[model samples]
Target: MTVKDRIVEIIAEQAVLDVSDVTMDSTLEDLGIDSLGLVESIFAIEEAFDIQVPFNANDPTESDFDISSVASIIKAVEDLVKAQS
Candidate 1:
């Protein structure tokens, strides 16, 4: 699957929602994913893609990785993957 599709799946799993329910505009808050879930999702994404995401769990607002929306997360991951490759 593509990066976007994999990310949606990971986020959906963390939120305990169906993949079909996740949209590009949806935020982690909108998916009912709390801080712990967000951390878990980030870990899963990192493991799945073999890349380290520049996210600070203690201070999400200060982090470079954007989790504002599903689309943003997808874009960030895609960019990371491209840069690493």
Candidate 2:
């Protein structure tokens, strides 16, 4: 699966929703996912890509990573993956 697809998958899994429910414009709250679910999704993303996500679970707003929407998250991870190469 592509990075975006994988990201949506992880988020959907954490939120206990179907992949079809996850859209690029959808935010975590839109999926009815809580803070813990966001953290878990981040962990899953990190593990899946073998890349450390620059996210601060304690203070999400303080982090440079953007979790505002699925599309933004996918863009960030795609950038990180490219940087690793």
Candidate 3:
């Protein structure tokens, strides 16, 4: 699956929803995912792509990575993967 597809799956799993329920505009809060779920989702994404995510658990707003929406997250991950390549 593509990176975007895999990310949607991860986020869906974390939110306890079907993949179809996740959209590019969906935010973690919109999906009812808490901070723990967010962290878990981030970990899963990092593992899936084998890339480190620059996220701060204590203060997510302080992190450089954007977690505002699924679309933004996808873009960030794609950029990271491209940078790695």
Off by over 4 Å in 1: none
State the weakest 10-residue window (summed lDDT) of model 3. 56-65
Q: What order do you get sorting by lDDT, best first?
A: 1, 3, 2
Return whichever of 1 and 2 wins on lDDT: 1
Residue 53, candidate 1: alpha-carbon lDDT: 97
- Once fitted onto the true fold, the runs of candidate 3 whose alpha carbons sit more than 4 angstroms away are none
| Pairs that collide, model 2 | none
Model 1, 1-85: lDDT tens per residue? 9999999999999999999999999999999999999999999999999999999988898888999999999999999999999
Candidate lDDT scores, in order, read: 0.96, 0.91, 0.94
Span of 10 residues, lowest total lDDT, candidate 1: 56-65
Every model's TM-score: 0.97, 0.95, 0.96
The sequence of per-residue lDDT tens digits that candidate 3 reaches over residues 44-75 is 99999999999998888878889999999999
Name the lDDT value of residue 20 in candidate 3.
100
lDDT of 3 at 42: 93
- Model 2 spans with C-alpha error above 4 angstroms: none
